[model samples]
Target chain A: MDHSSKRGDRPGVSRRDFLRGTGAAATAVASLVKVPGVEAQEAKSGADVVAIGPGPVKLSLEVNGTTMTTNVEPRVTLLDALRNYLDVTGCKKVCDRGTCGACTVMVDGKPIYSCTMLALEAEGKKIRTAESLIDGGKLDPVPAAFVACDAQQCGFCTPGFVVAMRAVLDANPKATPAEVEKGLAGNICRCGTYEQMRHAIEDLCKAGGK
Target chain B: MDNFVYYRPKTAEAAVGLLDAKWGTAELLAGGTDLVSLQKQYIARPKKVISLSQVQGLDQIEQSRGWPMTFKIGAGVKLATLAASSALRGSAAALAQAAEEIAGPQIRNMATLGGSLCQRNRCWYFRDEQSPCLLKGGDKCFALDGENRYHAIFTQGRKCVIASPSTVATPLMVLGAIAQVLSPKGKREIPLAEFFKAPTGPEDREHVLAPDEMLLSVSFSIASDKVKSASYEVRQKLSSDWPLVQASVAFELDGGTAKNVRIALGHVAPVPMLSAEAAKAIEGKPINEETAAAAGEAATSGAKPLSQNGYKVRLLAVAVKRALLTAAGAKKYWEV
Candidate 1:
């Protein structure tokens, strides 16, 4: 599939550099580049698509503002791919199941649990994680609001909350208290910082997301 | 997680053609909110994971406004979109309410209608890889004798104790929805009532979906002015938690008198159950406090709760009563 045409490309980010950033073994990346031709035929042709594989295959992801290519097993989740392959670890991984919103990210402007999503399915989609909010050492308005209101306690779930808050505010800048509560219901803070988070959200809604 | 070949098919036919009769040969990946978790827990280890993300036209919601106004909801439509849809709120209010109350925002943003209905029971024994339950080809179900708190109250001890966990299923059943299923053989439509089946044996599954078939869309009509429909769910927490009891009601009223009624309950049985007795009790009766309460009492007629889940009987009755009152447009019912 032509994934690059949909999104413009960046020059400096190489596939090997991204794989190295993800901390994958050099041999594993080597084997992944070689297995694509055989798997591509099985997947595209009328032959059975349920082909078995214990090897890595070439995959590309459009993350943040760049298209990064890598090799990974089909079983690797989006959460694992972002953290391990692309070194975009801002989205925390807690309660690998969909219950906790700690791994929340935006896919085509919609917030979804990255832990439950497969990396292969996100090949050509526009993905925005918490890492994208930090542009040139400046925090995005949502994270700034979070810091201003002291909305985090242990800081483990802060990125997910920030992403969720960004999504909610972007969709409804003047969101009511009820809407904020409903929109952020997926995320939980073990440190009991919900009251502070609400305060931050209310502040943002008042400021029109600054 | 077990390694599997991932195929992203651009066409619906290609997606279904990947399916084989074997249990773990290939599994459809829709939304991945439930399927990924099942794979993580080792409950579902398919050799091939066929992703339907690239398949076109399965993510749109089409509405028709003629006689028998209906909404043809694509099975792949996100739950959050369905919940927040203003079109659905006007006619299919119960479905919107059910969608709004399922899980949390992140999960709702990713979970699809087909995925929610096809998700297996959340029985701890069934979810735990260590326990060899009856559904997993074991001799006995551990939920029958251990940790029976969340087990079924209506269909207890049949073969599995896990209740149907689909929050949307209850409302769909009350709306008399029809599921359009596409098989390798052909396309067929089945009513929601006949879509789910109780497990008759060890090899049986919950829904009638074959291994090679895929759910295309779920269509339901909401036309009559006399019909008022609503859904009520009572959960242990206000956050994203599985509902303890859920009830959906659609009442056909003629000048405050219930001409006909449909009441369905979830999380209390192996399937989303239509309470015929409750509906019969309120038929032709004025929808008042006394009649509503009586209908609620009659709804628990054939409940056979397990040792620890007897408390669900009262919870189910209360949910039914509240749901019926909500559907009847009774003022100040939530206050009581």
Candidate 2:
């Protein structure tokens, strides 16, 4: 409302006015702002920084048991980083928008969405993708139980769901189908495999998450 | 596809410096669950992406010493990590449940706590991956007149209709959590409820985060044992989804009577909707079905839901009652 501010009679304080007023105010307020990095230095220890390229980043993954690393584009997801860069294509890439769990992987023994992960951050970190579930080309007991319980259909979302179920079974060793459903609730099988997946976890419970 | 620069800093100060240097043009990339997807969809085409993944200790979850003894969670902590965290198991169990319900394991692994709290809206028109919606500096907020089934009910009159995308923070707000932010200028803390901004006027910012600021971490204290909490999500399905309506309650108990109750409902409102009226309904009273139902009714009082989302009223009511009853010790360990 102040015509003295010639920034076209700006509705609020124009950028120029903001600078005039808050420039002085910013200094006093600035000191009150807490930079916690100095006090909380222990949080980030031995951090690694890899340049995500004009192309891809130089990414490495000790997936399952195989230690693999490669250069990938900055836009590449961990799912794509594995499939295209390292050829550990066990984790699928369906519904790349994250509604589906087709790109589930394990980082440092915890479940994560591979499609949403950046490959550069995986450097020096232990990661286990869905491909790790198979030993010497043999599927894991959970996956075998999946076959027994008929947990999958079409096999597109199978690898991702398998890895997700693996994390669940690992976290809750003696889970009921109800717990399995809750743990794996983040995953989606467009083919309506929820019932079978539940049964498979139940079968695993019978066999002791083996 | 234009080239975008990515910087991964291991500390909050470094991220703050990077953000302050660039100011309004730059963005802090956490979890990449939303930022990267937005990039892929071409919704947010920032020139600089300051990644919080490497920020040294932003991913930690620890308990702090105090009179009430608070638990602090770093911003870079993952949803899956939060869900499986032993620290939040009893006091903030609703937050843990919400964290678990965000997406599938894949996205949870990559998405950080701050990212989900600070993530942009998922409105279809806004995320067209092509069309210039209102949030992208476009003139008309497509949700104003477009398909707005998922739009907000409480605060959105027509300007910005994007529902907040955070699954954990809503519960945090109900539990009265505090967010700590760091900037090149310094640091500031605000209540979780006050952190999110109402998109009423022309300014399109979703949260109160300064252009030069970065969310360093969040900490809040609860009764730990007396406060019982739970999250209720009405998703289309167990996995393939975000909840249609999510409600969480953190209630203090006194000989089966609710005391100092906190109620928060998400997805149905623009930001996390806190109901003082709902809280008062159960405060100093026995948490019975009638009272829980009344609390639910009070929570959803005066809902201005959109055409398709009128269903949220009932859904939120159920969730509120369930959460309240659960928090008041009516149920334990969720009948799973």
Q: Candidate 2 falls in which docking quality class?
A: incorrect
Query: What lDDT does candidate 1 reach at residue B111?
Result: 91
Off by over 4 Å in 2: A1-52, A55-57, A146-152, A193-199, B20-24, B64-67, B156-158, B200-203, B331-336
Tens-digit lDDT string for candidate 2 (A58-133):
5667877678866554455677667755667688778776667777777887767777666766767788876677
Error of 1 at B94 (Å): 0.9
Q: What are the TM-scores, per candidate, against the unseen true structure?
A: 0.91, 0.83
**lDDT tens string, model 1, A1-210?**
656743237556576576565456743664454342245534344442434244666778888989988777778889988888778888888999988899999998888899999888787799999988988999888899889989999999999988987888789888776787788889989999988888887788788876
List of chain A TM-scores, every candidate: 0.78, 0.71
Q: What lDDT does model 2 reach?
A: 0.73
Q: In model 2, what lDDT does residue B20 have?
A: 42
Error of 1 at A62 (Å): 2.1
Local error of candidate 2 at residue A65 (angstroms): 2.9
